[model samples]
Target: MSISPLKETIPKLDPPNNTSLHPPPSPSTHRTLRRLKSAHVLGSSVSQPSLISQQHKQSLNRNFSPTRKVTNPPPGAHTRTRSNSDANVMSPALSSPISRRPQMKRASPVEGSTLDRLIRDGPTEGDLERGLESMRLKILDQGVKSDGDGMSSLRIYVWLVLLNAPVLETDEYLSLIHRGASPAYSKIRNDTFRTLATDPLFRRRVSEASLIRLLNAVAWKLHDAKGERSEVQMRLTNTANIYGSPELQHATPAKGRSRATTLTNDGSDAGKSEPGTYVQGMNVLAAPFLYAARSEAEAFIAFHQFITTECPGYVRGAMDGVHKGLALVDKVLAIVDPKLSLYLIGKGMNAELYAFPSVLTLCACTPPLPEVLRLWDFLFAYGAHLNILCIVAQLVILRNSILNSPSPTKILRSFPPLQADIVKEVTLTLVKKIPDDIYAEIVIHAK
Candidate 1:
């Protein structure tokens, strides 16, 4: 009954079944098996036909081909063959020697098309209400949208509605123009010629005279508001002192004039101007209105409402809101991209140092006016103050180059022209990260 050593060493098979007792090999393990099999076949003097199929031999050679490294299959796949088209379709991240960081994609054009539906056909009252609701929801859900055509009627109409701009009386605007320019007329004139100087869209479409008129109209509006406020103050002041005070009672003509001047508080003789007077960047703000509107009066109305109501602080004597905006830009950038924020701060490049024009002009400071309009659409839809976040978004977009540069402060001096859609996408994302209290400041800072 004793078996020989060779016979006893033989392994027994399981009872007949469709499947093997062992688990199937994974792609990686299968690949390893193929490598071992290929090496044994190449080294062996005796050819084993079953172990070295012609197809498997070709696959082994393909893996070592000089042209490209063969891609591995997923964990449990059975096949290793990939066609030339599939190889070509492989992501550059996989195919290239150096992988690129993925860029923030501009929000899709479909989102824009949804907003464009507002103006695709002029909506009636019902249509307009529904369109507006749809636009507002989409903006809050995503962000407002626009395309490359900066002067689309859709854009202008959307802005007018978003701004809640009234149907201005032609007479009112004409009267402002007829009254002649404000004392800032010379300053407005100086800035108008160079506004959008190189932008072919602006240059060919809007004349210098038209730009000057719109700016002067805004200046006049500012003057009128100042005068109204001054008149109201004069009415509120006590006049009893003028009648009863000894200084006024004993006044010579000179004393009377000086006393009267002191009482009025106008200070016109000293040449002091009011706050919110025309500033240089106002010209750039007016550029978008003029470019988008069908008429100068229309531009005048939108520009007037925009500055006076939306961002009076930006144009006021100190541009205090703009300064605040710059500070907020720094704070926001820090929250989102701390490395870039700290690097800029270390380089003496806070927002004040670089973002003034952007804050003042609503990013119309940088060109391709179409992009500015696109940005404004978002600003108008959500809040103009979100621009602080938008500026931060621009800094974030440039984060990599900025961090890597030797002199980031100098590099930021003239930031690139806006890719507004991408900026809006990033900005909307950043808005959620901002603390509510700081977000409130962003809203009021521009008021």
Candidate 2:
């Protein structure tokens, strides 16, 4: 997949078993989060005015944070060039009025329990001890009945408890983790200990000092973009990174696209229903992912929060319309091509939004940054394809459950925000049941 292959056909690489991990950025993909950083590579400007960076070919990590309030796109900017060298593409443009260019040059640890739990410590020693104890009990209980599927099973149990907290007792759920209710409950306890310590929600209840203290446990990841090799530092191993063919990267989103006008989406027309399908509240086009109703709302709120409080530069990126337009294209493409879908999940790895510190790790509750860098290496290899496909299929897969699931709350707890594992699992399975020709059919348009 050479960048020079201006107009080339994408190959079909379908096999079967689709195993996904970390469903955060449910509405976005590994690329969406990672793309926010500075890519050293340069593309042949599209059309709109864009800025040219001298830092092309730099395969390093660069964080571009804006400090001002989010503003409109820069008018009359130079167009961003597209290259055939990356899975997801990038170029330079105006900075957001509120862009803070916070160079988190210092790589932190990955902050989740499932993969690499780098503990930075959250508030009281008691909190830490309790959280750890809670996880330990969870592991033992789950492990008691099986050949070691405890932790995985416990993950589901946690999701269910969190999503459908019928009794709404945090301690009960916390107790579930504290006691040996399920196999590997201990592991969940350990992981949750770290997560709860750093969890913003947890911190909110705790003192501000505790929240800041807990963040130290937070880690960072690396992103591979179409930038200069020296610029986009690669961190985190055994994860998804989106620096494949540049043309594919830029084209994957195929700008000028719009959100779903095909049917009643979001809460707007959820009232209307057809025979086989009913309307759900999920916002299928949220940047991080197409999610169940509440998730969509959460994501929208989170994104707006990010746009306002975090990355003002995003508006600048949006100005090129690359962020918003391309994102919309990516969303549309996700539906059109499974491979191009947006779910970019990394199981048991740091779920950093991008592979770089600049992108600002954005998964709901996953591993930290440093460990996430490891994951991006793999992500960048095939991330472009996975970026579009995963997100789209996730929507398709969830559309039914989201729209009509008996227990809608379970949607959030049932799984992590991202669904990379599902993609790997489904693709591998499809390979066997599906003939080569069928894959070819999908791949043809996947480009």
Candidate 3:
């Protein structure tokens, strides 16, 4: 089915003339900087904003240094001041405002294990794919372990391998964050606070500042890409007009109308607006990466790889990929469990009404955050398209309750908090039941 483009105008995000690419930090940031400087780790201080709160610092410590025991400071600890000389003698981790957390310990693979060798040796693209298949099977049979709070020792590296995410430098991500907020800054701020808002596990571990920074950095990247694409399109349009191409003439908007207001054969506005630079559900999508990643930059790399490659359509104008995925959810559910599918449909319930968040966030919206992480382990392992079948599996698991309920919508309004193991089991079974054609559609629905 053809999806109509959204009618919104793309906002220009070019910085003002006086604004430098690397603007000086604000007063609060300066205080943070001084704190880092005092800790004698000036080099690492530039990696993140200095304004990281005390709570966030502890959370980071907990997530990355899973084995370290964090002790509380004595009362009136905030009132004490340290001299530069005294700070120099203190350990960097103890003195720095944001402690340098250690990377999670890698599981010691068997001496000759294929997965260990692949990870240690860094396989080529073809070899990596083969390695990932082995890894996928291992993950399916024995799931990755995580702290109850969703922090995993090895999950981020696995996700990076599965996504084939490039090795991004800390400076590269810092540069984006240093660019300050993008045109979507206000929109991003609005959604960041609400992301995984009700989940204590997520709330405690991820700082609002960190989430805002990651999303804003992503917005800037998207904004820059959109600008480049627009420039190329404009150049092509100009060249076409100069050549007197009939197709160009037919496609050009009228003098009185902007391209965004132009109508197409589908009777819908043929707008220039691409997928949004910052959409609402993106905060949810980015949350898991931040929760899983060892650092913001690591999270940025994985999250960027995911949106740009795995599911570009999901983030595009009107989230056409997500809508497509939703429709597929209904179809897959019918094939796997026709009784539940028809019962829900007869009650005027459909995937569109209930599965939007699940579709858009890859089931991250449902929580018990650790379970979400486990489910994601599977998604990143197999194929993300399997999430469609996973959603169907959720329905199948809940079939008894839904079929019996007079109002089935209440049961489906939210999936019973994600049961990753059972969901994966049902999903694999459902995968076998899907016809080849429908399964093919499931595979590419997010693309």
Candidate 4:
């Protein structure tokens, strides 16, 4: 079957008539709302409620109130009390002042209709999940709008809701930072300087020192979790040895054997190498969170939640998840656009060679930081697994250029500046062409 080009114009829905609850939209804001109405997001018509009840709006307001107090610090730590207002206040040890960092602008309720109200007034408790789904739909329909400085006033909060990441206390994050450098601190230092080094926007917004702290904090969390898991595994193995038959006892590996190297069905030597607390390309993954977040703690919360939950396999021992994702990219391409797949394979241009960074960093490796943020809005909302399909979408976009080139590797060497809308549209189209079984694999490949 052949794929057809998508229409440039997407149909728009009428804005809800409720003007009393939400502030009226300015001319520019009206244009943005109209664009949002266009079903270009997710490529389907979503019927939104015409009006949110007053009580629901109140519930949303109460949910995000800035009056909450900070959690108590662990014993032997600081005893001073703090509030949500202090969320942005960072410890001197955890951060260094960047001369060029721009002042963050908070999203205003009067900015736009849906997102503004959601940001100003959070979703109701009973409708929390549904509200998040609504936010996702809005984000898909209308991306998180950022300023010229490459900052989105509300993108971080939207991501927090979509990822189901709870509000981490400032003290908790500081406590992690106070632990000093992690075991992987030196390795993290080596990678942080090189992260997004060439992107001016990234350099202007995020600093290497901030990146180091966020990554090292995450390393400490992962290290501690690994220790706990090893302890549990040791106990289980001991229990088995004490109760099991002689053959079972003999089959159990020695206690010091590295569990990180255990083999899987794939032929990769995941079992041969020892896994470390930190891995390469993580700096790229953490860059966006730092860029979007208002404070380091907020960034840490979102970034830590993302790695630990969304794509743990990508950062785990041998990074088997990334390999699996890379393999799926090849399989997905073959299935969706066999002609292009055959052409690339004919030239020996498998995704493993070209798409590794995209898979490992969720396309953060691709340039135009703004577009990367837009793409992530979609990924965080729906599922990160669809990122595999998004990579295929990029290939499909470059189908002709790659097909006609004698040296396709040159064209595939680096992806063109991210065109988030086109890629998302193509990705949604390709999603239909994928078979259920393969699609199922895509969904869980990251986990």
Q: Which candidate gets the maximum lDDT versus the true structure?
A: 4
Q: Please list the residue runs of candidate 2 whose C-alpha ends up more than 4 Å from where it truly belongs after superposition.
A: 1-334, 337-375, 383-388, 397-400, 406-421, 424-447
lDDT of 3 at 2: 10
lDDT of 3: 0.63
Please write out the lDDT profile of model 3 over residues 164-233, one tens digit for every residue. Answer: 5654545566567667767888888888888998999787767777788788789888889878876776
**CA lDDT for candidate 4:** 0.64
lDDT of 1: 0.60
lDDT of each: 0.60, 0.24, 0.63, 0.64
lDDT of 4 by residue, 227-312 (tens): 77667665755665568634454454653233312312122343233245789988999999888775666677778777776787
**Candidate 1 lDDT by residue in tens digits, 223-284:** 88888977765664446354555556777878876776676576452223246678878888
On TM-score, who's better, 1 or 4? 4
Off by over 4 Å in 1: 1-131, 138-148, 239-274
Model 4 clashing residue pairs (backbone) = 60-122, 261-271
Error of 4 at 189 (Å): 1.3
Tell me model 2's lDDT, rounded to 2 decimals: 0.24
Ranking by lDDT: 4, 3, 1, 2
Query: How many collisions per candidate?
Result: 0, 153, 2, 2
Off by over 4 Å in 4: 1-113, 241-276
